[model samples]
Target: MLKKAIGGSLAAMLLAGMVLGTDALSYVTTACGNVREAVKSEITPEFELDRIRNEIDKLMPEIRQHMTVVAEQSVDVKDLQREIAKKDTKLASQRDAILALRADLSSSKDSFTYRHVSYSRGEVEADLANRFESFRNGEEALARDRQILAAQKQTLRANQKKLDSMLGRKQELAVHVSQLEARLKTIQASEAVNAIEVDDTKLSRVEGMIKDLNHALDVRESILETEGNVLGRIPVEEDSVDLHADVVSEVDQHFGLTADENVAEAAQSDSL
Candidate 1:
């Protein structure tokens, strides 16, 4: 009887040990599963944040490059406008010179003609003939100068047209660039908001980049506005002055006087 009781007690102890060991193992497995799920959840967001950060990094240089292009274009337009103004001034001066020469020849021819008709056989007549020849040569030279001025005016008009066309093209490019920048800003804003919960530090960095880009764009826009105003303010045509010059030129040409001088006088008067 003592042996049997001892055997039964040993069996009971062994069974209890087995049950405890099984319960411990089950608890360890459940904890391991929960830990793995938590690690997986954390890893996904981290990976996503890293991806967004990389995308932003790649985009920054492209944005900067585009901004640089806009700045360069603005500078080019300003230079072209300055050149146009210089050409216009040169053209006006040339026109004025032609008109002045025309006037002097006309007065001299009139005086020579009066002397020739009133005293045909004297030293005064010989002097008058020489004066007439001088006046005729002067008138022919003025005609050549007037032709050169016309050619210069045509060249200036062509240059102005070319510059205006370039300006228009640049304006179109600016508008397109602005639109693209706006779209990029919207995308960055959305991405930034999404990243806020996952990584605050990275979000702050992206926000900084966005602020810098915006500041650069603002500066470029201001420059474009100022240049536009300055260039647009200059008139391409002074129609009233041009019309008066044309009328004076016609009168001189019709009266067989030197029209170059008339053209110059009219241009000078119009300048005032």
Candidate 2:
């Protein structure tokens, strides 16, 4: 279908160009190239590979048929060889018999004997002439057959080589296709790997929230410590004041201690 479309497009372009005049011919090459590129672009690698594989498969039957023909030809060549060998043996015997008959005739023999049957010189001569004629014809026929056999063998060798070449090419194509498939798989896998993505936006927001909460907690703890330190201190007066003597005497009287008794005891002790 694509081939037909391309062909149609090319025809239309050619027709249009013809209508436009010789000046349009300059653009034909460029237009054809563009069309070819467009066709190539539409053909995917996988589809092309499949097409190649199918073509390879389609060749198999023809190859097998050729193989069958070659095999049959091989058998025919062998059979012809055997036939030629038999003919060669028969010709050798006939040649020896002809030579023997000529020798007999050369001796001026008036009669010849064959299996106890007798023949005059004339009869032997006639038989020799006929045998010679038959031998010549047989030799010619054998030569022709030999030529045909040689040609057939040559053709078979060439064909066998062709088959071998085809088989080798098919193997190479199969291996190449496998390699292409594996490479394509690797590329697709890489693309899949490349396609993977991680969205860290929400994760980053959550992390920010956690950090803010930590900071707030730390600030609150710092504020509490500061307030406790400020409020837990003992209030003290900076100025030093002398205690009132009356207050001291009343404090001493409350504890039942007399300052005059203590002073009298201390004076008596000092005099002793």
Candidate 3:
């Protein structure tokens, strides 16, 4: 509105200046006669004024349209603000109602406890003690498994070494048997064949020993793998206790930490 007023004032001043200037020029020209006609021929004041008025006329409709839209928008904005204020008031009232309901629900809930489960001081203490006992048992079991794992690992190493020794001996025996067979092949004379006539008992025994060694190693390895599974996820010192500790920590973190507080609360409730 202020901008429009200023622009209108400027246009009015321009129009006024044009009119007054043309009249003054006309009066001067009338007094000067032919000199004024020459000036008039140069200026064409009427034509300039007519052109300015035509341009102003073209702009006026657009200005009026802009003003009309602005007025409508202002009314719409005021209505929107009123609507928003009403909604805000409604929300405030609803918030208060919700607060009141929550208080009532809390009071009712406190009284509702009389209808169901109650705990004694002894029971609550016993319950937590059981959890503690279970936790301790889990730790002890984990440690014992670790010890057993270490012992069995040592036993496995010993068995593996013994099995290797048996395998080495069997290999030596096999090579000796191959040499004997080659030597017999070299002998062409019947007397030489007769001299070399011997059973492969030692070779059979060595092969048997090799087979037994392999079987024993396989069994030992299987036992170790099974024991590893039982010991749980690798590195018994860390992983074995992780699950138990996590569970206990979660319970401790969530429940009130001080056992004394629980016992006291139970005692107070029991007295009531």
Q: How accurate is candidate 1 locally (lDDT)?
A: 0.64
Give the poorly placed runs of model 2, Cα more than 4 Å off: 1-42, 202-272
Clashing pairs in 2: none
- The candidate, 1 or 2, that scores higher on TM-score is 2
Root-mean-square deviation of each candidate, in angstroms? 53.5, 15.7, 63.4
Query: What are the Cα lDDT values of the candidates?
Result: 0.64, 0.90, 0.62
Q: How far is candidate 2 from the true structure (C-alpha RMSD, Å)?
A: 15.7
By summed lDDT, which 10 consecutive residues of candidate 2 come out lowest? 233-242
Q: Cα lDDT for residue 6, model 2?
A: 100
- Candidate 3: 10-residue stretch with minimal lDDT: 106-115
lDDT per residue for candidate 3 within 141-252, as digits (tens), equals 5556556555655655565565556556556655665565555456535657677855699889999999999999999999988898888847554434578878866876
Rank the candidate models, highest TM-score first. 2, 1, 3
Candidate 1 residues 1-272, lDDT tens each? Answer: 99999999888667755877667556657878999999878775446555655655565575556556555655655565565556556555655544554444445343323325542234444554565565556556555655655566565556556566655656675566556666767888899998766677988999999999999999999998779778876544344467787886788878877757768888999999
> 1-272 in candidate 2: lDDT tens per residue?
99999999999878977787776766777788999999999998889889989998999999999899999999999999999999999999999989989999998779989889999999989999999999999999899999999999999999999999989998998999899999988998998999988679988999999999999999999998779769975435345556797687887788776888768877999999
User: Candidate 3: what lDDT?
Assistant: 0.62
- What TM value does model 1 have? 0.29
Clashes of each: 9, 0, 0
